[model samples]
Target: MRRHLRKLRSTPAVVLLFLILLFLLPYDNSFSPRAAIVSAVPALFEKRWWLINKPGAYPVDFSQDVAVLVKSGIGTKERIPSWLQAHEHMELSDLLLIGDFATLPGQEYQYRDQRLPVHDVLAWMIGRGYMAEDLDHPRLQKYYNLTRAIDREDVGAAQEMSGSFGWELDAMKFLSGMELLYSRFPDKKWYIMADDDTYLIQPSFKRLIEHFNPNREQYLGNPVGGEDCRFGHGGSSIILSHRAVSHLTSDREYLATAYRESLDETWGDKRLAVALNRLEIYIYEEYAAFFNGERPRTSKITKERLCTPVLSFHGLSSSSDMLSVSRTFEHATEQVLWIDLWNIPTSDKSDNAHLPKASTSLFDDPIYDTGHANWDYVGRPDEWTQSVEDVSSVETCKQICREERPDFCLAWTWDSNEKKCHMSWWIIKGDQAEGRTSGLNVPVVKGLVRSCRP
Candidate 1:
């Protein structure tokens, strides 16, 4: 049953093109008149602020500029040689490196600024601090997609220099790489991010820039994962908005916040994905369907139909000979079926290290605020926390509870209807409670509750 369905879902090109065109065609409406008349039921796209239902032409790629960044945790001794040379033949700019600059044993290779021979011309990338490392395989399996290729012998040594390792380190490196690259590559309009292991297809620059046009204004990939997706950790090859970049790094608060949440005992990209889900972000995800508990676990894709090529994160190829670069592009060839995660799981709700709990409704609280690092924290909600909800008949008694345990209740004094006692949990330690039922607990939700945790 499933196999056949998968086949059917993998619709053919001609048919898929017809469908996208159908939705794209002009109709007696606003936004995109041509598309509206063809495929989509007008009602399906009703409140789509980004929807082009108005009588107009399909959105074009006015935002044509681009830049590409590569994150390598492993060295280039083996596979690095091929990719190091790939940028030269393509239309993309010099490779922007992020992560450990030198992964070679004894001697650190200068990947920060690409190290092509000086006369090699491209060797100029070496001057910029953006660099790549030699990532190994096993470490790749730990998180979603940020590459980690340090030597097993030196992993501990690297950790000592900076407990600031892994995706966090890569993120910092990318942030720094972008900051530096932005200055060097003045013509670069938008930034394209990927890992050293990722085979970046040629001209992905155009595909992504079109999707992120400032005027188009819809959230772009790597938007911010949801409670389950974990921000910055959802997948590799995220297309970020320039505004999104500042949004993440602009505040010291957000940077510090993401660091704390990311270090949680249960922390990882997935955990961050959940936290990110609450933030304003999106992505061109493939696993979104399967990972987000969508009913169908599989889907197909076809290109040529003009399906929006925001970007594709995963692909399947039975051929052992296929290169990761080519295989990823193959998926790009089809009409990529997407799993629309109801919640990005955006990138704000990771568990806390010491805070007993994080409220589910971070936005609901007055002090609760979200940051660019994509983490939300109790910011002192002020009267707005309960005042608005109260004026709106939402809150009667404004209270904050900082309990270590929900099950730690006396049960008798806690009255539900009277609003006599409202409580919030302040987490102390989750790693310590892992075996006890509170393993990953971190005050999961916050709102103007009339009572304590039910």
Candidate 2:
């Protein structure tokens, strides 16, 4: 009986020793504790864990299936080489710069040591009978005279003529450019048209295009007008699939009508939308958030667009601004989100970084005392506003912003003259306004940023 008891005690000790050895063994072995524990979990959970820990990386070269057309004019053509330099890393397969006038047949224009074959869409339209000189209107006569001056290398005369009729010529570039693109590179899966001042983010643009079928008709952009005459804002950017291009260009009778209509239309983008509506191709309203009509500094970062990918920014007319934005994302390894734009510095001398990083704490609130004078943080249409009585000051304005819900108030502006307080749900780096003061709710903004993190 004593021997049996000793055997039982010894068996318990042996099992404990085996367990300790299993845990201490190298993890590479199948029987090792770490490996065993990992194998016991479900495959789905394991995949999610791997995804969370993986590096954020995207493809660098995906422009083979895409073609980008940049609209320029003789006056604004000076910015072309700089724009090209900003996007040189894209290695685009076909990037044609089209304007109101074309280069001589078999001749290319030289700018800043770069040779680019510039197409004259206006000339093409006249050749195909899509455009004719209206003796009564005199607009076509002025356009023809300008082209002739350009052909003769008379820079002074061309510049002077364009100053007066530049806007009129701009309306004609849209359809003519589209026709030129269809005739030249119809095989491309995607076609993107942008103004000289527009900046396109390549990674996000590629992601957006990949989401849709290239063979189907797709027209997308930032819708600006009402439902009656809705169209994508020209300055933002316009995207068209190969099928959409074919629908518009295949019917010559419709093209002629569209071209004639372009002469009377005030905005080319609206005219293009009208032409597409006839062909049953309307704007893709669902993806409007991807396109921004404002530059980075002035873009409104709303909660609805916090996590959305940004494809383009308009009004980057300055070469330095374009270069600055390009450098900001040149080395980006992941997709550029709207939330990411908040991090751009507000001013050249400002060491303070924007969103995703908390630059200040509400606890140390010094902004109220030295409120931003002569500044306006523009509010959204649904923003809150109220007039204050008695002591109407910046402190009173900021207090109102603080008392509101975090989601409803991210910034505030005070009108000193009217003694009114305006609260905005958006975080904007505002512009200058006399007799107004503005401030931001930094803590709330930081909390919002934290909530959006992966």
Candidate 3:
């Protein structure tokens, strides 16, 4: 009986010893020590932490409050699948896809298994006599020709005409879509209008709008153009509170005036702003940084933007780029700030490894191999430029960047043709230039990153 009691006591000790050994052992594909620990003590690591680690397992759904509208055309219709794939995890309440083509009223198209309601701006215009019976009307000629070209399925003619007349169609689409959205979902608190390429960071966007009153008229986005004609850059994602949309759509006279202006305007976004300006609803310039006009890889990670939560990224070149960005932030438990983008792994092979956390490291190393050949960091207004004696090579340009005060030089680009080296105070991932090379001051960037608020 005493021996049996001793065995029972020893069992608990043996089990404890086994657990200790298991935790200390190196992890493999089948098991992770960190995950094991998390599983063992569920109370210590909260649900938020667990969800952060397991991406796509627990998605934040904001379907009740907001509706997203994607503005696209037949030319870009193929991109819709990728766009849908990117936002698959975001449980949006209503996603309406609008274009310039004609569709029967209440028609829906099945794409990638989702039955999406289609809004045809062209059809709406025809029904409303905007593309009137008297096709000879000076303003209606272009619309008439474009409609004829589309009807005949003349791909070449349609493409050519669309290049010139598409802006007008797009403006009409935005106005009509707004009205339709209000009619379909008048209860929605907010509506977002974005291009097919634009990627909205749902969590950050939700966080931003939550602070504002949906009942108030709000027009918000990344403002562009002059103050007189300032409008939200459409590709950057334009946001409208329910009241704002109501005001724009409810006023028929305002809509007519806006449509007339659209015929003369070259861009739809500008026309939308012009229409709203008459109603005293201007773009909320304060939150401009939240609506980025650049893609993740090319976005400028300046000091001013480090702590700001990113709401959307515009001008993503491909669907793959969108998917990659979606994967990068899929598991984020908190709002994704601009600073967070800097640590994104360069490639899939380094998926588990983050770039060394940005910190104030004193070591000044001009990472030579990091220079991108045939690429240039475009000069900003605040950037410094100097003529380099050794125009034939990029070495001197790199040395100049390294020698400058860390605060003054975050990145440098050398132009072979101009024989000039430009150093920017902020880090801007620029575009390709045939005869240029660009590199970064790593240590200075680390310091800049460290300066941002958590």
Candidate 4:
């Protein structure tokens, strides 16, 4: 019995020895569980860190932006909804749809073989509360009478375009469609219009217009036509409140003339702008970031500049591209870093693009030149615009904007005292503050300029 007791006592020591060898010692001939565990420890922590910091996982921080809004209601004592409450108000059913489709039913988009932008858009729209009667070029008789893909004829044009290029037929179709849609669905609170090539992030779009009352006469879109005549870039899509649509329908003669004049215009977007302008329905600059002009897989600038949840992108030609964009932004992937209506980058910059150099100014370039003679000074300092710390000079700022953001850098601002420069890919004239040195990307500014009554 004593010997048995001694063996039991010794067993504990033996097990402890085995565990120590198993965990602490490394073996050359085979895999080391101990080493694996040690390496995995760091990896486990890394994965946990990533989960905690995941984008869109938490509510957005809009303390500063909200404060700005509160300041506007100084004496009135208006109640301000929390950001969460504002987001909750934007439901899918709140939107009324008007999509622009070519009379030709199914054309394969630019990138993929089987994927069709029209069919894809239609399929998603079917059960999503959008009515068939509401769409532009609604299937009156089913053009080909072919239901399935296997039944259709050969694929036609890669993309359906309007205005000029002898595509006047398509442009006229849009004008007529708009007139009919508004006539039928005139009472809907909000009308969202987009071409087949457009794909909307519904949640993002809802968040954008939640603050605006549907009863108000608000026209929201990316502002084009420079400082004079601003309109939304229709390719990116536009939202019209009931109040704005009323202006279109209230007078029959004006509507008739607008439609007739639009038939001859080179760009359908311009034609639409002219009609709206006649009604004095000005475009609101706040929603400009929602209009992304860049094609998918092109650049990150379009995503960063809006500084809001991305609402819609214009150049998603392929179904695959649309799917990717939808999935990518389904969860807020990035936080809106800035809240200025304009003067934000389209997308965030690469993680390691430019770092602050020093506290000293690198170049003595005038804080304000006669301006980039070619460029218009799109006001600044850009909203929530971060200063590039080590850039040192205006030349470096200009060079960085030119090389790094060829597609996105529309305008930039420099602060000589702080030895910093900031680049803005998007701009809002309303956000323009005085005494700030600024420059513009002239070519881009010129492209968006439309002849407006000065």
Candidate 5:
């Protein structure tokens, strides 16, 4: 099971609305009339928020406000206009980023300004001065030294790497970057290696790092495995904890030997995997779920119903796609807050929700199969499930149910002792079964449903 979702972290506007509701709403039975007025206040505010900030209401058009604001260097209350402003001042300097860049100016320099600040923040592992005829240039020597330091003598060729040469150059970049970054920032807690095409959501990445222990030797990223070794996908992103970096750097000669062996590999990720395998370290796979590239394993349909927050989306080639995804994520976060805080119903949010809510179907049996084995739904929890704490009041469960399809949310159970709320499409029978689960079918919420649709 996933850790409890941090849905309570909401936008400032939602927080203000909650504060007003908590204090201004009458809590006493003595003030019955006032209480009735207070109850209506939430509904009114919900509509107001929906009308102003609904997903469809604010289209992702960068030409409108984003361009104006970005050009003027005016950031919203939550975000900084410039990439460096948001991170350069942060205390988490212990983390290092190593990004690979190609020699071509057409692709590399074209999007330099538009490139996300995530790459500029850390040490970029690239051969900047290799284009010059003189190999003895200080910059070229630095590049040469970096390649040698990483133990990949096959990579630091004096000539520019073009066409098919990219493969070997990329592998050299990865090994060189790891060695250089470790040598530069030996005490750093985490290191992220990514390609120039990769886009990262830095804030969410920080949250991921904060949630885990960096002292241990762990690797996090999208898992791409060959027959022999499984490594974090470099294109998507690869995260190495301090211990992992330390382990790799602990033996200089051994690292050099491994690097030499991996020089023949086409893919840098595969080469890294080989090194990790030889080192007897396993890669942790959860980060891959969060850090997606061109192919997203998780679909849009299931992502909403589940309470987990998506950390990043990779493989965005164009600047527009990058900006769009970034804004979409921000907007989705706000929509979730409105849904949870205002108890907005999930009406036609997905095909699953649109297909008969099980309430209106006359012939369809609304009741769930009562007698099933323990854990009737035994698969892993996806984005379609929600687990809240202390949903003892049916009202609370009904509120969360509105965020999903009425038919899909078959039942909900609340454990008083644990104060855990487990919602499922599956419903079980019996008075206190193996688990402290309880609740009615989706039909019970038909009258209570609130539509988010226009």
Candidate 6:
């Protein structure tokens, strides 16, 4: 009996020990569990960071370029709405769209006027800081009345508010636009923002912009001076610069914290202007020049300078006629050998082969490569834009272009800044052996290669 009891006690001890060993043992699941984990890692290896402009990603090896983006809301009718109404869809251009802000609650704005540079109306909102007491001001009531006057129909507040809302919102859009634009083209030097209501006749604006202290990180529209700048209004229409706009819109919280109270208080012109200006941080008071410059007419400084210190702002209060003028210019757009990608002539390409040459493998080359686009073994990037491998047969190339929806694309010179495909159609030939030095008269679809603007 003594031996039996001892054995039973020993059995309990042994079972406890077994449990501890089992717990300590690294148990895994299925097939040699350790081998399964190793194999699983092979599948995980396929995922990787994607980089554009990498030698292994694009056909041509280069980076950097500029982009011109427009901002407008089709609150109403169609001026030339297919791609962009800002420049009227002219060809040979660099244009991007900054969505129309909440133009109209219902998408239909008071469409009777395209000639008014409504931007001028914003002047009334400038200056001033929101205060706690102004909540009872009678002018606030009037401004709200004005907002209601601007738009009629159901939904959202009519112009019951003053320009403060618009100004703040514009600042938001401007800042957001800059962040997004930079993200797309990490190396671009500047961003030019334009409006749809004006007549920007300065074709050399970019060159002039570059000429001005290319090293200076920011610029003003057209510099002007006025002792009364604080109490006075100045500036031509153009407001140029590259600084972040956060400083201008960051302080709306004091009044903005309570919409019901603040909206009712921002009425009187003087007080309202003070509150708004407090939020607008101008890089330079150069705005005064845009409004009070020596030349009232459009200034043409030798392709490099504006004859007048200030550029003209013709589209205020009346832009319809000017818009018509722009349309007339569009008619003159001619297609003269500008499709660079469509194999110009060998002589032309050799003249400007500044770009690095890239070799191509047939779509399926089979010779240690990830897989050829044609020859499943040649190792060029699958994402890179195609560079010409052989141009001996020009007619065959043309045939291919025609068969593929007759789209003629401008040759893209890789931009290191933006690190994406960029084509400068605004100034280039299309039919040359290599590329054109002029614009082309292609269908809107053909214009799809770049922006549909001249």
Candidate 1 lDDT at 196 equals 44
Report, for every candidate in turn, its global Cα lDDT versus the true structure. 0.33, 0.71, 0.68, 0.44, 0.43, 0.31
lDDT (Cα) of model 5: 0.43
Query: What TM-score, over all chains together, does every model reach?
Result: 0.38, 0.76, 0.73, 0.43, 0.42, 0.32
Better candidate by TM-score, 4 or 6: 4
lDDT-wise, the better of 1 and 2 is 2
Better of 2 and 4 by TM-score: 2
**Model 4 Cα lDDT, one tens digit per residue, 1-454:** 9999999999999987875666543222133354455445433322212113334312222311111000001111111112112222222322222222322445422221122122222222232333343334324223212123223432232122111122333343344444444664565656666654565545455455554565666677767876557777766777776676777667766755665454455565666666777776667553465565544333233223423344655565445544444444444433222222122222323232222211112112342332332232333344534457776766777666666775767666655556666676654322233334556544443343211100
TM-score of 4: 0.43
Displacement of residue 39 (Cα, Å) in model 6 is 72
lDDT of 1 by residue, 34-57 (tens): 433423454444322222324223
Candidate 1: misplaced stretches above 4 Å?
Answer: 1-64, 75-78, 101-187, 203-205, 215-219, 222-236, 265-454
**Tens-digit lDDT track of model 6 for 1-454:** 9999999989989976865554344322122333334344444322211111122211211113344444443232133242243244333133344432224334432222322222211122322233343456554444444445554542234322323244332332333333334444444444454444444433223323433332232334543233322321221333323332223234455434423243333222222223334554223332233232221121211111211122233332234433443443233222211111122222321333222111121112221112111111111223322333333332333333334423333222222222322222121212221221111122322333232112
RMSD of each: 20.5, 14.0, 16.3, 23.8, 19.4, 23.9
Which candidate number maximizes lDDT?
A: 2
**Candidates 5 and 6: which is better by lDDT?**
5
Worst 10 residues of 1 by lDDT: 293-302
Better of 1 and 6 by TM-score: 1
lDDT of 3 by residue, 18-136 (tens): 76676554321124354546546645422222113233322324778788888887556666777887787776658888887654555465544567865666566567655446545
lDDT of 5 by residue, 181-248 (tens): 66766656667765544445443455455444566666777778765777877766777767777787
On TM-score, who's better, 4 or 5? 4
